[model samples]
Target: MVPAERRTMSPALRRTLVIAILVELAVGGWLLASRVLRVPPALPADMVDDPLLAAEIRALASRADRGGTPEWRTLGEGLLGQGAYAHAESAFARAAALAPQDIDALFGQAFCIDRTGRMAASNPLYRRCLDLPDRTEDGVGRKPFALYAIGRNLLRLDDVQGAEAAFRENASFLPAQFQLAKLLVRDGRLGEAVRIVDDLLRQLPLALELHQLKARILEAAGAPAEAFLARAMEERSAHLVESNFSTDYVRPFTTRLGMPRVLQEVESRLPPVPGDPRRDPAVLEREIQPLEALVAEARVPQRATLAFLRGALAADVDDVAGITAALGIVDAAGDRSASRLELEALVRDRMGDAVTATALRERAAAMAPSPQLHRRLAEESERRGDHAAARHHRARADFHLGKAAYRRNRLEDALREFREAAVHDDRHVATWYRTGEMAYHLGRRTEAVEAFRRVVDLEPDHER
Candidate 1:
């Protein structure tokens, strides 16, 4: 019989094997129970007043009443309360699907999605709720919260113009005056923003946020003394918001002066040139006198900035001597590297010192090769017919400009710039090849072929 099989079937051995298997099975079952049977805690007693979400939750409750898992609702509410926004979103989505018309579930889903940083997804849902004909009259169409959400989202995306329009539309519906004040502050209407915040603080003296907003607005409006007082009040109110307040943890309010207004002021104070004859010399001197006086009285940073501005104005007027004088002032002030370099470049350029200008530009490039500066150098080199220098500068400029142009669908211009850039730097073989591909898309067959051939020569194995 094929080497008589050893009959090793002992009862004790079989019993031990069976017991081990049973223990494993018991452990696995416990693990499964732990994973699938654990229930989430209950929601807070006070329900959120968001009607759309509330209705959706009610529908989910109805589904639970119909013998669906009560665990689903519990999980969703628990996730929402604990700020587990993403988890809450999925749970609420399931709850909403199970009971579509449940306003609570829908609102919960939207709220969770919004809080989870899914503005693109949440916006449409919020809009859909607002568009519904059967929406409740509890200010559904005119709800400040919904409007604020949309506005805040737009602001976060840097869609300032859109945010301004939305905020204006919903200004009347906002529950707190502070919200409107903050929006105004964001819009650069510091005076109005401050007025609104002041009104709110009169009613709610404990509103530290309102006080801080007022302080920021006042500072932006140039009322430094009043701003400091308001900041003091804000610190006092901080203790009420939370005990054991620490200054290090507190967010200091910021003041942002409007760029356009600052530019306008700088422009207005610029000294007039003699050759322009556009305005009276006396009038120009009078206009600039106040600026000079202000410069003397200003803080170090502001004085340095003003000195740079004056240098720029002098260069604009072809006043080489004046430019040099202003640059000296800036240098004496110190701690204005950017302004110093900028003024130096301007003066050098104005004085027809191309070599000096190039040196300064190279230094600036090494420091910070901003696209504007690169383009300036490129254009200047091109004007002087220095093709090699132009090519180098253009390559630098194109590195930045190409992406911006591509984003704006100016493919032809981008292709041209990339091609020119490739000609400037043979080491950028990949960029050269990409230029050919872009040229092909732009229908420049001859240019594309030349670019491709160049790439092929650079790298024999390069695939077209």
Candidate 2:
């Protein structure tokens, strides 16, 4: 963890401070010149506009001055909610001085400090808050939110492992898990991200974001059909009017001459495999050759993806030169996405430059903060014997590619993308609604109804 003295202020905090400084500058020195020593702090009208909150602050201040029981803690909490962090911190400090054992005062103080961009200084107070005795139910001895603050602070410090540990310490806290998942994805450890999100979904089945995340993971893992199913669930969970498209296991196409149908036509013309045909490498290569040739001959920009696919086929056949040639074409076509980086890393790895390969992989992983990337990074890092880094980068990827598919109105492709996105971010109500709409359009009433039910469950006020 970064020590307070060594930790640099975050950009957001710096920006906030700069804005405040600029406002003070604009107001000139009159305010500062008029200030008195120990001037009684007044509530900012915008923050303490509500009558009840204003009254509560006034009452607490009066009680504190009279040496009454420390109702100042309650006032602190009210001020904190109103974004009056400085006043809240003072109130909490007073309450703590009056009642040393008041855990709420310690937590409130730490929370206020943290919110005011003094995270490093707040660390010790957080520890003190958590160390207090358990007075609430759940018997954890500390408020779960304390762990959340600790996790967020650790994350800001780039202490990925520490953040993960803190987040896992309080499993019921959703934001911690989400943060951990993001770190995992950024590090390219998709499998672990999937497991974390999957477990969370079991508890929060109606969470649209989680489902969307899972879908994205599936897509990154090359499970298009599974992604499609996930998208269906996500769409069904949305609050929008659902579509009626049936879920199909086909890539979306602009023309009626869709890839799936075209592939079927080509398959009918090819010689049948005698045994386990799908596993026949030679046959697969032969089948893919025509597509490769077509892609090479085509002048269309979108066909660049076909070149990348051909590179994958070459890799499967251990055709290093073929992979290089195909990838070179993709590069020449000006593709620089995470997928392109991943392919470059793979080729470098194959060429026996382990160091360069690993670096490239890391770069690719960093470029795409997805579950799939993290999973791939984990695999690569584990291969290089860096289990800790591998473990840290194991979150799921999102279904951006699938969303692209969806945008083209390629119902089947869109469904797959939405499903993949939902897997990673199940709380994505939009995806769930789209899935339901598509399912309904395809006359899959049962599936549509199930998806619609999820939507209703997620958003009780959702219109059908």
Candidate 3:
């Protein structure tokens, strides 16, 4: 065997070995070259940090710094600041992509999108920034700012529950002192929001924004006297701000800071009504016309507020027609105003238009998808003697209400609640046909017959 193995290699075999070795070396060389020469994949085109994009971003930033001609960032900021949402949105979108993680750019983009009536678009950006890992010494994450942005966006989208959830989530992140207490109050979580502001006020006593926020919150929570006092303090701060600045500067500053005063004046001007006769028709009608006029000229938030005020005035005067009219105005004023829709349902109920009211309530229920709205609609259906419709609405209401009650350990209450619900809506077809079912339930044979007769008429094969 050694003798055979040791024989000299053949020319063809030697050539093959050499060829294989050369191929391997060639492949290895190619791989090594690829590794050394290849560039890393570029960051997203919009991300301003990209080396390739840095020059363009720097150019834009320089232009913004110049501040005379409208540069991308400055134009966006100015439009956003001035509440020209649609224009701001276009500008900020460009800026955000150019500087992806630029906090001001992100905030401006999100705010402008939201202002331009695009809550769905704004929410994701707010969430992304809010979810960013915290590097601050406090380690408190961006939760507060994120929560506030989300809540504001939800409010604009007419998602009250979603807004509440977001506000509650970041309520703790609010700088132990900030000036948005009023927003929290309007959110119906006033107590918690107020506590945060109170702590902040202790630290930054001279902060005009805090005082204004506190006043607005107090006013929203129905603490008029405290709000008035807070307003006075804020006014003093406004004067202080003006006195500290040049005349030209003061005028612009006051114009920007005058929201609190305008709000206070509006609240103060609302006429008081007597408790026993809250709905003084004349006063209600008188108050509504001006509010309607305001609705026509106001922006989204202001218009929504005015519409709500008009609705309240109409309710005070027991003017169903006025209330209905105000609701229509509110509905037309903005896509984000659902509170007005809710008020409209109430007005319809008060007007004794149960059938139409039920439909309106159902529409609201569909939009907000709330248990309360469903319950109201179910009750209205029961009142109208539409057992089938009543059953459907009641089942939906009971399903949600039961979950709510069960979470609170009210099992018996939930069961009784459903049982009571069943009395109003006999779901089974047999309930309609049983001889005494309708009579006993309705308390009148003729009424039962009429109801059953209608059911039978609709369902030709049904028997009584």
Candidate 4:
């Protein structure tokens, strides 16, 4: 970790400070001739206008001056919630000084410091919170959050293994679990990531990001049907008109709990073993019953998924008529989603109907810009001598690739990708912001500032 004394401030913080300095210089340049500059002393709750809140703040201050840990801790929590980090830090410090064993005070102080982006300084303070006895702050346990904070700091410091270990220890904490899964994905531990994501979905089935992430991971793992199901889940999560309460083996599209292995066996097309049960037409037809039942009972995404799986199983047994019938239903189900369309396209492509598959895929790509799909489209477009279309698809692919690289702390690669993305998609705020962030990390200050200025120009309210 970079020590406070030697650590350089992040680009966003530096830019803010630089702008403030310039404003000060501009205002003071002529005014200095007449009188010395006098800065106003920042006071706690100075501008608070809500009568109840202001009175409460005053009361907290009064009690804290004469009282101990609880009063100061309460005041600190209040200030922290209001984004008054400096005042909160002081309050928490006073509380910790009076009662060093107060986990709340220690955590509050460390958290206030962490919010300022001084992770190196706050890391040890979080460790201090842990060094003491395990305790609860307010109504929640502190250990999990503190461990998560430590892992976050470790990741920021580029201590990948340390972060992984910390996250592993704090697996029950959702943030820690998410980080661990991301790390596993970065390391190409797809099996591990698959399990983690499955568990996370069980807890938070409606998390759109997790579904999207699983889609990407499954796609990368060469499980297109399962990936498509993940994308289907992604679409379902977005509406959230109804909560998805189902989770577990019965949940569709899981790798271990579902049928990626069976699908893999079918897709491999190796000579069947003499008595392989899956290759038996009778057994395959029997397996189709449960899937047919599932399709009947399930909704758009899951119904589509079950139909596709049934088709795959029927195809494995060379039941051409059965496969065609099942796939026809799969094609009709989940028609509103790109995932369903993509899955249908993949099946059609596998069945040698390239023309129809291409059309469906192109439409799906337009709906949701999948990096892998875009990359394939870019290749196909280039083959068709459509340079402009290829470039556009390639640029989108580059942006997402940069994001993946950034997630893994591969900063140099991320910078390259974002720089390329910036060249193609200059009007996009996300591209500029990503470009600026990567440039700043890679020590290209001028480029970073220019990209940041472009982002600000595009979206004046954008911060970081």
Instruction: Give the true-structure RMSD of model 1.
Output: 29.9
TM-score per model over all chains: 0.36, 0.42, 0.32, 0.42
Every candidate's lDDT: 0.62, 0.65, 0.57, 0.71
Kindly list the per-residue Cα lDDT of model 3 for residues 271-372, writing each as its tens digit: 554453434556545655654453354343455556677778767667788777767767776645446567876697787776676676677777776676
Candidate 1 residue lDDT tens string, 435-461: 776676677889889988888888999
Lowest summed lDDT across 10 adjacent residues in model 3 is found at 241-250
Residue 13 lDDT, candidate 1, scale 0-100:
88
TM-score of 3: 0.32
Q: How well does candidate 2 score on lDDT at residue 248?
A: 15
Error of 2 at 120 (Å): 1.6
lDDT string, candidate 4, 113-147, tens digits: 88788989998888888777766434556767788
How well does candidate 2 match the true structure in TM-score terms?
A: 0.42
Q: In candidate 3, which residue pairs get closer than 3 Å at backbone N, Cα or C atoms, i.e. clash?
A: 46-97, 177-200, 279-316, 279-317
Q: Tally clashes: model 4.
A: 0
Ten-residue region with minimum lDDT total, candidate 2:
241-250
**Poorly placed runs, candidate 3 (over 4 Å):** 1-296, 334-340, 350-352, 402-464
